[model samples]
Target: MGGPGGWWRRKSTPAKVETYTRWSFHFIALSEPTVIGVTAFGHLEARAALLVMVPVAAHVALAMVTASRALDWTVGRRAQPLRLLWALGAATALVATAAVVLGRHGPGGPGEDTGTVLGSVFGATLCYGVGLTALGLKDRRRVVLLVTGFGAGAGLVARAAGMPALAALGTSAFVTAASGFFAATSAFSIWLLNTVYVLDEARETRARLAVAEERLRFGRDLHDVMGRNLAVIALKSELAVQLARRERPEAVEQMIEVQRIAQESQREVREVVRGYRRADLEAELHGARGVLRAAGIDCEVSGETDGLPAEVQSALGWVVREATTNVLRHGDAKKCTVTVLRPEGRVVLTVRNDGATAPHGSSRTGGTGLAGLRERLSAVGGTLDAGEAGDGEFRLVAEVPLTARPALEVAS
Candidate 1:
């Protein structure tokens, strides 16, 4: 929770807030009677009611104040402190427990001080156990104990006070149900806190990683764009410089052409990053068709590919791009087939091409072709297979999951 104002705000969606609100109401309903016990059943006389309600109310008010203060400090204006709501909840449970056990008495004849103390003890102990159960619900180690304590406490109190059998049964049932609900609710609450922490960490980590990756990619693009061209430009510039010494006109003109290609390459790299360079499947396939034809390779690509997950389709498109690149650039293949299949349970993409000009460069394609494809496929939780699928053929296949982890990050 961020604060009173921001405790309601959410990062991923508004639905988590809605769910949290529901859980809060459920918890308050289920445990309020335990906290404000005699008000519901008229099970206690006035003095007994006073004894139990006072301490319970005090504990709750203090816990809320502590939680609110910590939330304000941590989220309103400053970094998280070493504030301990878990300890505060634990302490409340302890004090309530002590208040309860010390005041224990048995049901007795009316007008007996002993009976008053005993009622206080029964109601407070029941509520205290329930309170502790509610408090440490998010703390996994203590939750089991608190839940067990609630159930056992209800049964013990019922037996001690000679409550009616139905009353005792009702108490046990209520405690059991409450224990399960709170345990689940608390688990979900703790998970929400952890997920928020993780998302912050993930953002920071991705920032650093994205910077590093972008830097590396920029360097690669620059080399691809300007490496040989820069060398040519530098040689021509030297020629122009030397020609200036000789007062020659043509050397300087050649230098101007060199400058033009370098400028165009720079503009293209910028465009690529800005998404001006479209790499759609149809255009890729249309290009591939021509390239394969020039290489004397017959290509059979089938089906209208639709409803494909973006990552999967992108990966498959990449397979087609790289395979076609390999065929035109390196392979002496005679034929290629790019098949796209969407069967009931899985999607499949296969690219098969005839063997290389040489026997096999797949033994060496691992340097960039196969290795990069594997990495891309793995990122989408898919696999890539590259090999001579049969005699004198090279193939690559990518398969990916359609859906995973159904989007409920922190519902409570």
Candidate 2:
């Protein structure tokens, strides 16, 4: 036996709750006419009771179908079969109307002719039809006109049929149509509200997916930045160990280089984690030259690094950094050349290195660093290509529009 708090925590989902509520209304609506028909049964002849009950049962069944179709319409789904059911419901109501009118004048007719029993049956059918029409009709003005016409028409027909003077023709028809109209409107309004709730839930799901994708992109960027830098530091430290075994004084210099790279890596990682880090193209060009030269590779940089937008520079700076790191870690390169050009409203950066040594069982297509760069460049409407060019040379090229857009704005 859970407490009230626990029961609330276990409450049904919106879909299940709505379904239960709709069925509850259906049962309540049908019960009223059903009770009336049963009570009138005891007072009438056996043949009269059979005539009244048959139409009442048919009307109830068709009304349920109509309500179900209305619910479908509110949620943007089609209930094509409902047109037939609507017609059947209306036909059964008319039959019940005829039977009730004839019963009042029969040998076993009730004492008074208040028209209460007939109105209840007729009103239920009208309510079902009105509710279905309100949602199925796309035009609001048309729905209003149709509802008004239905009410007025029902009243006029009742008046012409010669109901009792006290429950005059006008009074009888108005009561029936009005009862149906209000019942239909209330049910349709509830269904509309539930539809809105479903749409809101879908929007929330999309928002959450966007957030998750951004987080994944950020994680990939951080991994790309750190992975290459750490690999370079490991190579330097290993080289220092060998030099130390040979008892060379250059071992101390190698150790110092390792220490410097380690410290730089720490600062870069902090900057990346803070999310405000923007790579400098000039700094990367200079750093690439110095690092390649120290590794005994002749490096030449030819480019104007001035007067570029910050976004373009940052994206290209990453290209240069990753290319330099790849040359050191993966190749036995004797020389490397980097070129930058602004042509046709785009800035292009290319890094070409000789003595390329392809990794064991490595395809030209995949690497975390290049893949991450491609994603980053694409965020600013840029592109990257990295693969074997020809004659023992591997090339990495990146191109970006001069007026690069921010990644956040692009995502939006």
Candidate 3:
């Protein structure tokens, strides 16, 4: 649980009301006894009054705080608020300690009863709502569970031990245990809802943006191809026009040049529009060898790329990009290795970086820029995987069947 809205997320009204009701019930039942009793127990002239106030105040306080966290968690605005927690915690402690001190040392008049100071200290938690809110803001799940559990438990225990009011109103031990259980469940629900919503939102947003950005990029590429090719074709056609006005042989040659450029431009434009960029495995390996050497990482290539399809080559080439990016982002990595191999009609590419980086998906940096690889490879009936292969080694692997022509032969 974290932040005002991050603790529990249900932006809708019905959902908001539902979560609020549960938390309110859990909090009131668990806390009311202690919250009111703590202050009333020592201060109340009648022992009966002390018992009633303790449970009532506790219940109300618990319900209020729980409801607050539930609503805040639902809003998708989770954050850790350490200062707020510290401030509220200090204030709660001060109140509790003061109650205890007053109980022991205060001057007593006739009909006055000095209750145990510890009760005041324990009851002081009624004020912990502020810090609990802060902890919820920070999404400190475990701490809230522990604190709530203890507070609810102690209140019930005190109630059963016997209050002066015929022992009628105090909650039983079983009720106390139940309150603790409910408190924990409430906290977990908040954390779960927030995490699920956040992840789902992130995935959908990434999908939309990825498609849009790719379209824009491919659009620009198409324009570039068309512009350059059309310009060359136009220049050649003008030359031919001038020649056609004179001797015939030169005009025919100029027309041939125009045909070549126009054809080439058309081919390039089609490829760009189709989002097809064939990579020659042989060339990539050759390039990788030099690039890795310059970057001071070992690179090895030993596969015969001659018969492999272009899709496989493109997939493998992407592996190189993702691996290099991981290396650049993780500076602690000292060495990197890229290996290409082919056997049994399958092409495999592996890139490994040695460092102290966590496994893939475990780090935020890995989440972005790598998701597309999964769908991209799957569309072509292949797969890409990234994770830690061993100690100090982060590895990315790509294997896809050959489908398109090799980059060297795209034109031929």
Candidate 4:
């Protein structure tokens, strides 16, 4: 009842179409022997029919095994032994089928007729071809040659055994080989199509992972930029309230400073949110030295951050910034050291601070800043470790490969 365009509209997706095609070939492969058995039923006596069943069943079983091996090979697994076994089985089944089909009509007197013998040959050849093609051999030309040789040899043997039509041997051999060739190539085509589908899905999965990683990076950056500033703003606001209660004139200045920091923090958050926040290694190092010095803590930075990739610098700069923030906000330190070294094919950044703080649980364990830094480092094939060092010292170490994978490239 549907029009011509209706079929087109009702067509399934490419994945569904491929699945249907694969199953269709499987159905053909599984039913080929049955179809051949049914066609030769009327001509075959009861004993002959039973005899043909042996080779037919073996052929079907070998075909299934061959297809399984081909799939294994397609997915990059070992299948050499199975492929060799299938080849031997196919040859045996082909010979058995040909003999059973031709021998049914006695020695002379129109033995099994030419048409029936050729039809049986064609079906057996098709089964062998499909099974061989599923093997996914590298040299297709060799497969073609092998199929042709087998088909021709079968026809020659039939002619030598005095089949009815001797003149049609060449035609039957060519037909048998051609049918086998087409069936094998068709099965290979289905395998290739399914492989392409798998690659496309893998690409899609990588794309999704990229998007998710970018989101995480952005979130981490935002948290790192806002966490310390918000904490400082809260402390200052509290002090300003205390001063205002005491009617101190310094309350106005403190409130103004708090407002300025708040506004700056807001702008910085926007930069991070827009993905335009790139931390400068030199700037972070200089800032850390100055801030620690201002807090009466001796800070030493030993590193040459030049000649580093922008992405690498940005990632390392974030680490320095977060480490500095944690040192200032959490630890009572007398001295802090930041060392950056490029050894072999790696960039190592270590921030060690000697602080006498008891093991009072801090956000470094599950803090957003350190956690985000970890994620950022992971995205660039880097690692981060932050914990208490011996003798009341906390250390944060981040290491990234010098030839780290570019952020734009997705890892396979």
Best by lDDT: 2
Q: For candidate 1, write residues 71-139 as lDDT tens digits.
A: 334233444333444554455445534533343432344344444444444444344334433433345
Best by TM-score: 2
Runs with alpha carbons beyond 4 Å of true place in candidate 4: 1-183, 285-313, 332-350, 356-368, 371-386, 397-412
Better of 3 and 4 by lDDT: 4
> Each candidate's TM vs. the true structure?
0.46, 0.61, 0.36, 0.52
Q: How should the candidates be ordered by TM-score, best one leading?
A: 2, 4, 1, 3
Candidate 4 clash pair list: none
What is candidate 3's lDDT per residue for 1-412, written digit by digit as tens? 4678764563554456546645654554455455555556556656656544553454345435545544454554454444444444454444444444444443551123445434434353433343233324434555555455445544444443333332322322332344345445555666665666677778889999988977755654454345434544565677688779876678887688778767866786677766575545565566556544534556565656666665666555545654554454454666766777775666777777776774454352355445545544665677777777767677777887655333322211
TM-score of 1: 0.46
lDDT ranking of the models: 2, 4, 1, 3
Q: How accurate locally is residue 282 in candidate 2, as Cα lDDT from 0 to 100? A: 94
Error of 1 at 281 (Å): 17
Error of 1 at 101 (Å): 8.6
lDDT agreement with native, every candidate: 0.55, 0.69, 0.53, 0.68
Candidate 3 structure lDDT: 0.53
lDDT of 1: 0.55
